[model samples]
Target chain A: MMTTKNGSWKIRYILLLIALPVLALLFSLCVGRYVVSVPDVFRSILSRFNENIEVSKLAYITIWNVRLPRILLAFVVGSALSCAGLLFQSIFRNPLATPDTLGVAGGSSFGAVLSILLGFSLIPLQLVSFGFGCLAVFLTILAAKGKNQSMSTIILSGIIMGSLFSALVSLVKFTADQEQQLPSITYWLMGSLQSATYSSLLIGLIPIAVSIIILFLLRWRLNLLMLSEEESCSSGVNMPRLRMVAILCATVATASSISMCGQVGWVGLIVPHMCRMVFGNDHRHLIPACVSFGGTFLIIVDTLARSISAAELPISILTAIIGAPFFIFLMRRKGGWNL
Target chain B: MKLEIKNASFAYKNGRTLYENVNFSVESGEMISILGPNGAGKTTLLRATMGLLNWKSGGSLLDGDNIADMPASKLWSKIAYVPQAHNRGGSYTVLQSVLLGMTNQIGLFSTPKEKDIRFAEETLDRLHILHLKDRLCNEISGGELQMTMIARSLVSHAGILILDEPESNLDFKNQMIVLDTLTKLSSEGIGVLFNTHYPEHALRRSTKAILIDNGKVQFGATPSIITEKNIESAFGVKAYIGQFETEHNMIANVIPVGLTKDEEKTEANEEDSDVLATLSIICSKFEESERINAILHEFNDILFGRMGMPHRKRNLYLISVNLDGSKERIKMLAHQLSVLPDVSCKVTYAKEEES
Candidate 1:
């Protein structure tokens, strides 16, 4: 009954959501330390599918082994955090909500720190980190439960849990050996995609992908969650169930991401805000927008993280440096946003 | 569908009882207005009725099923509730916001389909808000947002609608649009129950009125429920309930005079008896004459004789009827006729007997 008022504009934006991430992925592949030319990267990728093309080993090794896994890792972590951030914002009905709102990152980082201090293997470290992340959110809910289930109370509990985990991480750091274990623990806490091997990626990608896909499937009902409490309940949708599902998914996504790549903070808050500014709050538009833009943003940031110096800089610093100014500019231009 | 509250009682969590032994039923084609003073549990009553808040003892029944035990999707598909116009989902456009009412019918994984969108647009168009379909709800005016909310509720095509002060804070024109829309919807066989701050709106539009006053809930025909004594008792204000003559009808208007500090109450008149009267009517339009005839037909049992004539050149109609009914019925019939447009009516009562 209603025609799309700006049909071309809508299509152009959709194209951008898809195209930006692909471009970022390509950029990440072509701009690393031992760089391959754009055509060589394309040709090397094509050679695997087509036998007629000649393959270059340097291009193949650089693209497939080192940069490709890292790039995919950026996309996975970025998309997962962004979707989780958006879901948390909707569930709390507050724009300030993010992936770490429940302290999953802090708890999981503590898990990694404990693993590193105890001299665990890479696989056990990731598993321990993921387990602690889930535990953090469970503790947050337990703390906030039966207090009328108001959102602010849960958020306050999340903050308390987050601080508690951070304190534990600090306690571990104070007692850790300063020679070897301390540096690795500190490096992991700063967040980097340098250790993104295929096996690690495979272990982390399961929870992130499953949660993101489930969040995407339930995108339409998310708008209902943004409504006031009584309004949402009377909408005939099972709001508490929806809220629990969203919180659980976001928890899994955030925990898996933190376990894999330390604490990638700004992407969760910034990317979802950018997507909301561009696409408004219809989760139908916001979910896909958050995934694509979130992935692309981290891909771009991670590319810059590795290339800006002889030594890789911490990801959190660059993300804040790059994301804060951009977010402030967008917020100022739009005046502000509402839930 | 009929929504019935039977022996429903409600109390706050602090053990303060809001209301007790409340009973009312609204069916298709009926408009029921809920009136009460501030903090008199008007909102609580509505929330409890919709099962948003639990009733302290008794529960609401939709048709036959217990509402408290019903699943949300099953319950909402039959009843639509429009809350205060200021809602939290302002980031959505008008069309999308209205389409939210279709969430129950929509599948868990799917977006709104073409048919659902069409229905949403049609409901907006029916409310004359199709022009603002793509506009964000926050970018629109308060009245426009209220209308959008109403459009959302209507899009569900529910058998019953409940609104919380749908016309409050709206401009005069928006008020008319909202009140008129409710009237038209009820005429088309949708039960409408709304909370209102205006007793006059209840008198003008609703067939049934409920007043929650002094911890008591009263329900009856609109005219009887909104009398002067009831208004004073409910709102703690001495107000005059008088009729104003408009071109089409006599409209009941409530004018509050001053606040009452004393606990004294006015007693309702006990005078009740049959009366003999002759009613005279005049109309300039044929439609007016027909409306008069329809009103007069309701009191057909009291009529002993009737005569009518049409003056062709002057295009006027004159009718006279001799009536024998209770004093209230005759006054009510005359009051009803005097309210219609292009008609003038008067009733003259017969003298008392010497016995």
Candidate 2:
């Protein structure tokens, strides 16, 4: 009976996590200034298949060109950040670890601000930010080497590298044009999905999807990374190779997401933790749970950010506001941060 | 399957040799216990044997193939390792934890199959912890946690299991339970190699004992290897090895007294003239007379005068002896006399010039 109960609970949680996102995607597609009905949204989508089905041209452009790409971008970016977060937590064996722990966000923000100050085009800006984010992680690893490669050493080096990158970002902001460049750079740092176009979605989706698939496929071995270095090695895990692959995938996903959407925080850190609390810490279940819940959670937050006031708010502001209180609730409910 | 460590040597990066030329082999259905004091390289030896650390000289062979040449997954599938009890900390259920041992059996990207789950269940049942299968590992007692770890290793279906101090943190009953489980596993044809601080445990459960002292290793059958002389030299303590009959069979126990410091000091003063010592022996039961006689006969070189009186009503034997010998020799004779069951010996020494 207990065995069956456990098996059924896992299946049910997985189904709920997956279904909730699809439902949220559909629901969010309806809630906006225009307030399209759910059936209208479905009819608009169905009109693509049956040309005879009558749908307004305005609805078609709003749904297909505007809302769909933005929502899809939000979902991909959210799930990518969450997957990177899970990878970081497992490989570092520290629950507090996130995609930003290795200075990816800080380095990418600096690169974005520098590009804005130099009057670079949008594509070059994204490429520059992605390159700098990866470079920051590489430098962090280089600093952490030759000290037995302990987790604490790597974490300490990451903190130092993160601070250095943040300082560089501050320097870039200080030197920018006060009227034109500074405000734009500050707004970009706040993070938003408002600029989510079909091209931006296409650019970020492939790497994020590829990385998430890799993480999902290797979910079982991710459990081994939770063990100590010696224990994992003795258990037949190639610790260095596994860790390198995981970090590389996580970095690619995080950098691509940040380069597209600027610096969206808290989703990466909090989504994985919330998933762990609900579905236990087994990565096989935890990874999918994070992907689903994270995608749905960000889409809802972005919807609220857009609708909460007349002017749109940045996605990061809403995520931190919601994420901080929920994290506190989780900590209080669990009695302490055991992780 | 057989595991052989042939002339294996290990040293730290700073050039201090932890152990050298350590040679031993264990086969299926055999248990080898490594005994040593704290910081005696016991853990290092185990790590070296498991290939967690590379050896500087020589290597291990599994079934005549070099272990180093084998892939880690292949070698680990044949030889499972369990770290110390304290190192296991997590929220995985007993079932999930044990299923982790199937790391090698399952594909890198694949979850456990139905047959892997069945194997894991059978392993838990074999360890008699099937009832704990659903319980979280951290919520279980330490002894139960230990059992789960062993079950985890067993689920891999490894032919050999190497544990580091499996009984260190447990209470007496739990210690016995863990040891007994290991013994049972060995009987089922799985080789068990563990390091422990308790020589009595090694004597009871281990088929072979390896005593590492001061960079040297002594390996042999448990009974022959765990002798008083070896124990004294290894641990600097005087020990007595004796056998007692239980309802089932005879069991050997090693009783270690404090270090032989007094004997060493007296031996330093051996140039002094021999002393005349008088030893009074009392036996509460008549059955102990033969053992007391044998003990005295073994020390006959120091015997000068001996007298025995049997009190038939009390069924006790009282013997008194005067001996001329060095203080060390006299003390050894008295010590032997005191070790016999139901017998006690007291000695009085008086300095005398040689005549």
Candidate 3:
């Protein structure tokens, strides 16, 4: 009886995951200002297989240049952030850990804000932000070391570094021109996928996809990290190499996702917990669940953000609106938010 | 299954050493109990054997192969380690906790196969706790927790079982249960080493004993060869030694009492006096007693070399004689004096040589 129920649940999860991207693609094409019918969207996507069939130039342009890139970027960034969150949570053995828990978001925001005030291009600003975010996470880890750095120490150090960086961002905001410079900085902080283009989307996909693949391959090793260091070592794990690879892979995922979506809050924190709640805590099933649910969750949130008003609401604001109450519920129920 | 530890030493980062120059070995199908006072590095020794601590001086060799060189998975397969079970947050079922013992057997990418489940079921059955397997660990009695730990160790298919204080913090019934399980395991040819504080516990089950004190191996011998003097030196205590009636067992019972300050000072003062002179004073002191004739008879026994008195004990009491110019004669004098109703006999040893 248990086996039968487990088998059906596995199939249900797989089917739901496969259907998500298709639904997201259809929603992205059909809900925009130039709304296309679902039948038209399907035909336009399939016409590439039959090149002899004539397709409208406008439909081709929307599918190729406008809508396709946004949907793909949302999936890539959602998967990256959720995977990063799962990695950090497992390493610290805390369900509350997210990409921002290590000051990655605040440091990246500080870099981007500094660049805008200094009149840098969007490309150079993103590069600087990504570089600074990785640097901040490493420095936080260093500050937390003792005889052996404990997980709680690392987490508290991350909080300190995050606050320090946030203070610097506030200082940057204080000196900027209110009408011209301030609004752009504020908009960037709010986070949006409306600025996504084919070029930026392709660039973000490389690091995100690579890191996700690394996460999947190292899923087995991640379970060992949940144990104490002595247990992990005696259980045959080469502790140093496992730690280095996991941190580097998780960092790549964090930096790329942050660069694409300017601090998309709470998806990373919430998705892993939701996955663990539905599935068990074992990373094999949990990691795949995070990927599917994370993307679907963000796609639906993004749809609400864009379709609710004439002007698209920032995705970050919407995540807080949903994530705050859910976060409280998770804390009360699972007792997993101690970090 | 010959486990040999030679010249093993360990120290913490703070420069306080837990153990140094330690050496011992145990053979297959043998039970060796590590007996020590509190803070005598018993747990440290167990951790070193389990490869949980970083050691400095030497290594533990299992059948001539260093434990450090063995692959972790194969090493665990040979040695089943049951860490001291403390309180954890969850109320995971007993069967689930035992299932976690099969963690290494289950591949990372795979679920538990039928064989793993069968092994767990069979272990619970062997422990006679199959009905309680579905109960939460928190809901069971302490006796059940101990049985579950033993069952967990058995499910690992480990040939050598290492437990730290398995009998500690357990009620008498649970302690006996754990000891019985260990005996059954050893009878099945599994090498077992466990740390214990109770000598009787070790004396009851283990054929061999290793005593540790001040981070040194005081004695490593079979139970038959373990004498009162050895235990006294190892634990710095006074002991009474005798034989058991039924089993020809040489029992060494240790008593942990030290001399009071005044008693210690008086013992130090008696060292300067000549033995002959002190015995002469004791004989004169008890010369006029009604028990004098009885004292003379015991003294004659000492004079004939049939019995002897230990030196320091003769000085403190008033009923010894100086006939042989030694305290052995004085002990005979005191034994005779002990028969008088008013005269009490007390024996003492010099502080340095007592243990």
Measured by lDDT, the strongest candidate is 1
Alpha carbon lDDT of each predicted model:
0.86, 0.83, 0.71
Residue B344 accuracy (lDDT) in model 2: 60
DockQ of each: 0.59, 0.31, 0.08
lDDT of 2 by residue, A111-149 (tens): 888899999977788889888899899999999999387
- Docking quality band of candidate 1, CAPRI definitions: medium
Worst 10 residues of 1 chain A by lDDT: A1-10
Whose lDDT is higher: candidate 1's or candidate 3's? 1
Which one wins on TM-score?
Answer: 1
TM-scores for candidates 1 onward, in order = 0.92, 0.84, 0.73
Ranking of all predicted structures according to lDDT, beginning with the best and ending with the worst: 1, 2, 3
Per-residue lDDT of B1-355 in model 1, one digit per residue for the tens? 9999999889889999888999999999789999999989888888888998899888899998899888788899889898887774646888888888788888999888778988888889888889999988778888888888888878776899999999999999989888888887886789999999999888877878999998999998777788888998889899998767654445678999988777666776787778789987888776457767887888898898999999878899999899998876776677556534357776778996676
Interface RMSD of each candidate, angstroms, one decimal? 2.6, 2.6, 5.0
C-alpha lDDT (0 to 100) for residue B34 of candidate 1: 97
Q: Candidate 1: where is the Cα deviation over 4 Å? A: A1-13, A49-56, B268-270, B276-323, B330-355
Model 3, B1-355: lDDT tens digits are 7888888888887888877887887776678788877788888888887777767879888888888888877777777777666532134457665665666777754555677777888999988898877776656887788787778777778778888888988888889888888877775678889998777676656756778866777444344324454555556654554433222122334344552343322222134321432222233233334345444564563342222232354432234433443453454344334322234433333333333
Worst 10 residues of 1 chain B by lDDT: B334-343
CAPRI quality of model 2: acceptable
Q: Model 3: per-residue lDDT, tens digit, A1-339? A: 111135677788789878976787678777776777777787788887888766788887787777777777787778788888888887776766887788888888888888889988777777787887888788888898777777788889999999988999999999998988999999998898887787777777787788787777766556666654543444444666766677778887888777766889899998888876766455656677788888878877887787788888999999999999987897789754432
